[model samples]
Target: MPTEYSLPDTLDRIYTNQLALEAAIMELTLLIEQQGHTEVGENVRGALYAIGENAGHIKQGIAKLVLQHRGD
Candidate 1:
């Protein structure tokens, strides 16, 4: 069982993490664009793309949580 503060606290943490992840994705996008490369190579670009996708999902999930909890 969780306390009253626990659910919101956990959601808050998730939101915070999503914000950071989105920022990281934006940074990667900038880097890739600045480099003007078609790909990130065999490992690096692949990892970045995967991270960006996951971050997007996290952001979406957090947004849903906010809507459910805060009526946004």
Candidate 2:
């Protein structure tokens, strides 16, 4: 038998991951502020920002998928 998947459960997992990513971004920002503009800090900050942006996009896509699935 094929494994069953639940849309709502998957959505919840995505949402939780998004929240954790946002929190990590916030913490990283604070650390950067405290550490000042060192080369390594700037590089790390940029990478974290990119990750946060991707996570946001992922969350939005998941939301759209949920909406479309429900409309069916």
Candidate 3:
């Protein structure tokens, strides 16, 4: 009876969106750097570093959530 609105599904969707946005931001940051705005790009990259750090933990947590629900 589990629908798409279930906990694991919701989290997975959110994670997917997170990854997509990260990619988009990276592309934009690269473009900014190419345009000679190195300082702006560096600041954006600094924030991206933090986001990348947490992304690993978020992915692992989502995997654990899905695994735990497999037995349900």
Candidate 4:
């Protein structure tokens, strides 16, 4: 099979999707809190915290991969 997308390109797309999902989930959490679901919102917030941290790491890793590819 012919190669379609490179590793860096695929990882970047994944990162983009991750960010979009994170934003959508955050919006939902806000709406949930507004509906008096503080406990649920809090739980979601905790999960979001972990997601946010991993996102930063993923972003950095992708950047490094792109930079390395450019040096090739």
TM agreement with the true structure for every prediction: 0.46, 0.54, 0.86, 0.87
lDDT of 4 by residue, 1-57 (tens): 222386888899988998899899999999999999999999999998999989989
lDDT of each: 0.64, 0.70, 0.90, 0.89
Q: Against the true structure, what is every candidate's RMSD?
A: 5.7, 4.2, 1.4, 2.2
Candidate 4 global CA lDDT score: 0.89
- Range of the 10 consecutive residues with the lowest summed lDDT in candidate 1: 1-10
Per-residue C-alpha lDDT of model 2 across residues 15-69, encoded as one tens digit per residue? 7886787688767767877877566667767787787777767777877876776
The C-alpha stretches of model 4 lying farther than 4 A from their native spots are 1-4
What value does the lDDT take at residue 45 in candidate 4?
Answer: 96
Error of 4 at 32 (Å): 0.7
Q: Is 1 or 2 the stronger prediction by lDDT?
A: 2
- Model 3 clash pairs? none
Give model 1's TM-score versus the native structure: 0.46
| Number of colliding residue pairs in model 2 | 0
RMSD of 4: 2.2
User: Model 3, residue 6: displacement in angstroms?
Assistant: 1.2
The model with the greater TM-score, 2 or 4, is 4
Q: Give candidate 2 misplaced runs (Cα > 4 Å).
A: 1-5, 25-29, 32-37
